[model samples]
Target: MRTIYKKELARIFKDKKMVFSVFLLPVLIMVGIMALVGNLTSRQMEDIENHESIVYMMNEPESFTAFLDASDLHMDVKSVETEAERDDVMSMLKEGDADLFIEFPENFDSLIQGYRQGDEVPQIKTYYNPSEDYSSSAYELISNQSLEAYRQVLLSQRVTDMNELQVFTVNSDNKDMVVQDDQKASGKALGMMLPYFITILLFAGAMGIGTDMIAGEKERGTMASLLVTPVKRKSIVLGKVFALMTISGISSVIYIVVMGATFPKILGGDSGLDLEITPEQIVMIGVLLVAIAFLYSAIVILLSVFARDLKEASTYITPAYMVVLVIGMMTMFTTREAGMKDYLIPFYNTALALKGILTSEVTMAQYGVTLAMTLVLGGILTAVIAKAFESEKVMNL
Candidate 1:
């Protein structure tokens, strides 16, 4: 078994294309794509921040104007009179010269105070060209700010003293009790995405090597030669599966390290995510990754053994990869914690377990269930592949 394992490893590593596909391709692609996306996002944010929004206001309130003026947004505010002039402002917006047109109703301040006191509120009209980027951005900023300012005014009138509010008085002392610190929150956010990334890498890394191991060799007439040697068929199957698992595991680790180092920079430096994964959690993650890799490699090996050539194996494996990806995506969008029944599923259990581990939400029961299921599935597939190895027809194919 050891000799066959060593031989398989050596043969796989010797193929430069296979080595690159298994080890370096995922990292390079992840880094390159993340850097590009991050750069574009950073530029868009800078543009939004530095943009000088041209705003036209009709009967604008002094309070709202004061709020905008006190802020650091680069805005060019102009006051206009009469409905006809407001029409001209709308024309400017449509023509792309101005970013926004806001109109406050007559007696705006008195009406707002009245509305806060249970009277009907007057609607404020805002116009901006949705097709224009600057206009849309300006409208979003101005509308949010205006609404917040109005909310503050209403709250001030209703709650003269926050200390006297019953809700505040009760909850003030317990504010820190339920608060998740920056690090934990960051871990949760990263957890949401990391599972999907790792799952895909594991399957992909295993697919290339697993297909080439049996299918490629069979196509090249090398598999028969290796089979006729003085080696046990079970050993041959074990050796190739072990080699595939090793390569897949290595690729997954590289992907994790690369994503960990680069995801923050891509999201922007000030994102304030603290991804301090604990040692225990790291161990859990490592175990989960190994289980998932083993399961995926075993499945790939089964497909490869059944295939007559690399193309046939890839054709059979592509849909399996897609199924895994779709399952991973479903796990990514999951808002709730994993239930007991969730661990009963195979590929999906790995994704949920990964999420739980990263977010520090996994239970011992869940971990045990996922690991057990994965091992059972892997063992079953390995047995099937070993049986196939002893079949003359399968070997001849």
Candidate 2:
């Protein structure tokens, strides 16, 4: 078994194309994504810091309008008198001229104070064009800050002394923040990066290892020659399967290492998001890596078992690429601290585990369950593929 493993590894590295595909491709893809993400994060942070976004208010009281002037955020505040003007402001937001439009109803003062006096809460509508990412983000920030300011004013009404001390009593002591930087535990960069890297790695494994193990061997006639040897047919199948899994494993590790080594510097330099990932978190990421390798390779092997030749195997494996890619993207869409529903997903578990490891909250039970599922699913795929290999038709093909 050891000899077979060494021989397979040697064979893979000996092929320059295979070595580049299996290793270098994933690294390049990861670095590219990190650079793009880091740039976007930096731009967003800059917009937050420097952009004087405009928000138009209608029928707002002097007190409420004064609150926007006193706030820390940079804003080009304006007042509107009619619905047509409000529509014009919304058009400006849609045209990329204004950030957002805050529509205060004609009875704004009465409605706001009435709501505070245990009456129905008045709806405060903020119009934002969804097509603009920064605009939407700015709208949400301003709306939240405005609501906070309103709350502070109401709270101040109760205090005999309306000073900065009242702001401190209502603000600082009221909210609790629990920070968990667990995403680093998953062995990827901060934010929506780990999932992208995982998806790319899955594609590399399916295309590089999957194509080479099945199709490339057929093209070289090595598989046909190996079958005629004295070794048990099942051993031959297991040997190739193990080889492909090893290739997949290596590819996964390359992705983790490239991202891990570059992420801190990228974050500090451009993204400006800092994190502290421990050695134990890396161990958990390793657990996820092993699980994904075996699971993905087993499935690819099963698909390859049906191929008549190398060209046919590559065609059959295209869907494997699609499935893994979609799953990784879906995992990216979901926030970290994944709920019970995420636990049931297959490819998602690995990404989730990676996210948890990166963020630092990966539990032993989560790792155990993810590992078990990978083994069970991989075992089923291996058995099915082995059975296919045992067929005289497949062997002959």
Candidate 3:
């Protein structure tokens, strides 16, 4: 077994194409994806962090400006002399130069005071960029904050009008949820891309290395030569399958390392969730590398053994990868509590495990179970491949 393994390693290292397929290509794909994610996250963070609500105050509120001065929000409020000025600010906000545009109509303070006294109706016209999604979103957030402030002021005014000696306060009993905190906007972003990354690495490692192991051997007449050896057919299949698993495992490690190195810079801007990686994270990632590599390699080796050539092998593996890809993508579109079915599903298990590791909630039992299942599946696949290798039809081909 040692001799066979050594020889297989030598052949893989000697073949530049195989080396590229097993190692370099997967790393490139991973780095490319990480880079793209970093760019997108940076842009998104910038949009969130530097988003300054552009308040084009057409009518001045005596207290509104003072209230804004006491707050920590980033807002670019300018007194607009005409509709043209307001339009310019609106255009800038739409172009992502500003977070949002706010317009206060004339008699804003008087109308609000009158409404508080129940002597007249309150009408405040605020112009917001409805077309810009972020601008509109910011408008809603600012509006909520503004409304809360208005409610507080109105309540105080009502208390004074009623001649109440004691001041009343309103407090919410809502608990600060941990899971809700974990699934923040940035966490959702991580969840959205993390699964796809795992699936891509798994698919690439399996397909790239597995295609060359079986189909490539047939194409090179090596299968026929190996069949003549005194070694047991099962040993040959095990050696090749083990070799594929090693290659895939190394590729996955490198890919994860690249992702870890790039994550901080990618999610640095305004993504409230920290992308800081720790030693524990590194360990969890290593476990994932081994588990997914074995699982995918076993599946691909089974598919590859049935193909006569690389093209046919790809035909089978491509569709299999597409299925995994779709399942992996479900983590993005669906909520965490979406379905219990995802827990039992193979690809989904890997995806969820990766997600857990990233979010710092991976359990020892889940890791052990995933690893055990992968090994069991790989062992079963080895048995099947062994039988095929000893068959008259497979040897004849």
Which has the greatest TM-score?
1
Candidate 3 structure lDDT: 0.70
How many clashing pairs per prediction, in order? Answer: 0, 14, 0
Cα lDDT, model 1, residue 120? 76
C-alpha lDDT score of every prediction, in listed order: 0.84, 0.71, 0.70
Query: What is candidate 3's CA lDDT for residue 394?
Result: 65
Of 2 and 3, the candidate ranking higher by lDDT: 2
Writing each residue's lDDT as its tens digit, candidate 2 over 1-397 gives 4555567778888999879867887688768877788789788878666777777778777777667667766777788888788778878888988878777666877666556556677677778877886577677778777766776786577556767563345346545564543344333345356766676676556565666676677678887887777877667667777777777777777877787678777666544355666778767777667767777777777777777666787788777778777777775676546765666678777667666666655577776777787778888888887788778787666
Off by over 4 Å in 2: 1-7, 44-90, 99-168, 173-196, 219-222, 269-288, 324-373
Lowest lDDT 10-residue stretch of candidate 3: 176-185
Model 3 regions lying over 4 Å from their true place: 1-4, 15-21, 44-131, 137-142, 145-196, 228-231, 269-288, 329-345, 350-367, 391-397
TM-score of each: 0.80, 0.68, 0.67
Per-candidate RMSD vs. true structure?
A: 4.6, 6.0, 6.1
| Model 3: colliding residue pairs | none
The positional error of residue 327 in candidate 2, measured at the CA in angstroms, is: 5.0
Q: What is the lDDT of candidate 1?
A: 0.84
